[model samples]
Target: MTDVLVLTERELRAAVSLDLDAVDVVERAFAGLGAGGVVMPPILSMAIEERHAEVDVKTAYVPGLDGFAIKVSPGFFDNPKRGLPSLNGMMIVLSAETGIVQAALLDNGYLTDVRTAAAGAVAARHLAPATVRRAGVLGAGLQAELQIRALALVRTVPEVLVWARDPAKARAYTERMAASLSIPVRVADSPEAVVRGCDVVVTTTPSRTPLIEAGWLHPGLHVTAMGSDAPDKNELAPAVLARADRFVCDRRSQSAVLGELRSAIATGAVPEDWPVDELGEIVAGTKPGRRSADEITVCDLTGTGVQDTAIATHALRVARASGAGHVVEN
Candidate 1:
């Protein structure tokens, strides 16, 4: 008989808090990936067009880790109308040595949210300007809040400008974030306004069309587009990517197929053979990030399995230390 731990969302949340530690774990995962010390497969995605939903399966094995996680992430865009969250998922950790089931992290997508936010923080830590007074967010969802909070960990953001399709939602987000973050949060009139007014911009929408354009870019600007995880979804115009001084992605191969890089390639904005740097390479110190203060940098994050495995591993460790999960025999 084998015993496996099962961690509920509440238990996991109690065990792990989204902070620099989470960022460090994800950064190490990326470094391992860049150094070829991790075994990561291409994401397997399935679309349910009729229901406006998509499911992605992602996994990775870091060489020295005792276990790895396979994450099943499902996004049903229409679920919000039914009073349900658009995102839901879980992770299953397997023993690296014996391939035995170790733990089931029933986070219901919470861990994904934390790890993704941590990745954005890592990007901002490495790519954003040294002094970030104002940050702009192009969404009013949970991620918009989380992304800004994550950025605050690495940079000083005194104010945030937010834009959303719905004015009421944006206003509500402004109120909530201003109070929670203890900073001024204002609503921007448009996506361009948000981009122009802030040195750091984060796009967290699930838009299928371009919300930000190239002409809005300015010197010393840093953009992190985390919305386009699927082939059909795009938040940045191809020209935005083409005009950036440095363009980075979590994984070039995955980006070429499912990220903003794919959209740019599809639209002929960037050639298929164009050289794009990986965030892992920069984190691993094999490549440079933001060489100049006036450089315009952009990072395309389509999400990665390395992040999942790393975050899951960290969560399991914390949970074990805190005795936050239950052990079940099989």
Candidate 2:
């Protein structure tokens, strides 16, 4: 009988916070998966029912070395009003050679958030300067907090600035996260204020229009745009992308279609000769990061499925060692 590891959201959260080390996991996974190998992550799409306020079933699959992981997520946005989380999802991991179902991770969305935040930190680790000490975070939701935590782990940033459309949430985030992280967290009046004096800026909003503009950035600023995961979503203006000396992304095709590259290319702000680098290339040392202190950098993240696979693998290993999961009989 083949052993299948099952992990819950709570366990996955604990794993990522202490042992999983998302920055390393995401960086290595992208490097290994991007070596002209088998890993492939396609974009995910779904429709919402106006009547039921639920998303219709959608298709998601990522093919890679170990195998493929399929995502199945449901929307329950009103759950928060009822004192519950609004998002929930699962991962179905299959065998590479035998094509048998290996494991089912009932981690809800915790694993995904960890991997996504880790990916942001990985991007910032490569694109941001080593001396960076101030960070600006847009959007005060789960992802924004996670990005701040993960980035702090990878770098020595001692202060963080947060901006949210809602002032109450922003103040609450500053108060809560600052105490937990032992860092000075401040709430900014606007998105521009959040990035104006910061060395690194991370945008986590789901805005259709741009939030961070080009004029607000100074020399040596590193911007990690994490909000634009879909085609219709974009947080950074094309001018902001044009101001960067170097541009990096996780997946080239996806970024071109849905990420900052999409708008940049459409507006002709990023020419054909623009220096576009992949996060995997930087992790593999095929490309350099932060060559100069005055070089402006931007990293557009679309969240790769390979990252999901990597974290899931790590979760299974830890779960098995801790005897934290149950075995379902065949």
Candidate 3:
């Protein structure tokens, strides 16, 4: 039997903190895909609609890591009334070699948030201008906070601007994240303000409409669109995508179906020949990220199975070392 490494949300957090190696693991997973050593199957998801809310069950298999992660997250409607997170989920990691049970992670959506945010950081590290000094985030939800923390790990950002529909929540998030990271956080009045001034902009909303406009983005700015991971979800305007010098994604197949590229493609704003390269291509030196300092770059990430496997594997290693998970005899 494979040693199952069950990890809790707290343990996952501790694991990410204690190890910079987790980032490397995730990076290599992408690089492996670019080098043709990995196979990331399409994500299969189903939505259960309710009168009050809906829940989504998603499964993805990553062949490079020889594992898969299954997740279930609920809609945002019941958050206030239930005193629970709008998103609720867990990931079950399995051994790819034998398809045996390996570990179950009760991350409560925390691991997903971190792994997705880490993807943004990876994108920024590759695509952002070398002189990047300021960052902006659109959306003040759970993922937004983690994006700030993750981006801090890569660039020397001294100031970060946050914008949310709710002024109070934005302020609170700014205060809390700023205190924790020792960086200056500012609250922006509009999404345009956040995109206009920052060298790196991250969008983590659940909006189906465009939040960042094309005109607001300056030359050399790097935008990470982490909001739209599913069909009918979009954050960046089609015009913004059309203006980018480089439009990169975690996976071309998924992004063509669900990411902002989907909207761009549907509107005919982006040409059929437009090459939407994968981040792995850049990591593998198969393609260059930023052609020039003034190139406008966009990294559209829909979260990949490879990322889940990397995080789950790292969490397992950490849990084993820290004696955090329980073992069972079967």
Ranking by lDDT: 1, 3, 2
- Better model by lDDT, 1 or 2? 1
Model 3 accuracy (lDDT, Cα): 0.80
Q: How well is each residue in 1-330 modelled by candidate 2, as lDDT tens digits? A: 776666677766655552236568667787775555644646455656562334422222334445556656666777788897777888767767786777778888777788888898888777888887789899998888888887877788889999999999999998889777988999899999988879998899889999988999888899999888777888998988888788888877878887888888888988755667888888878888789999999999887777777777667666667777667755
Deviation (Å) of 240 in candidate 3? 1.2
- Please say which candidate is ahead in lDDT: 2 or 3: 3
Candidate 2 residue spans exceeding 4 A from truth = 1-3, 18-20, 51-68, 76-84, 271-275
Best by TM-score: 1
Candidate 3, 222-314: lDDT as tens digits: 999998988899999898888888889999888888899998988998986677789989988899978898999999998887777777777
What order do candidates take by TM-score, descending? 1, 3, 2
What are the root-mean-square deviations of the candidates from the true structure over C-alphas?
Answer: 1.2, 2.7, 2.2
Model 3 quality (TM-score): 0.92
Give each model a TM-score: 0.97, 0.90, 0.92
Candidate 1 has a TM-score of: 0.97
- Per-residue C-alpha lDDT of model 1 across residues 1-330, encoded as one tens digit per residue: 999999999999998778889989998998888788788888888989999998989999998888999999999999999999988999999999999999999999999999999999989989999999799999999999999999998899999999999999999999999888999999999999999999999999989999999999999999999988877889999999999999999999988887899889988999999999999999989999889999999999989999999999999999998888889999
lDDT agreement with native, every candidate: 0.93, 0.78, 0.80
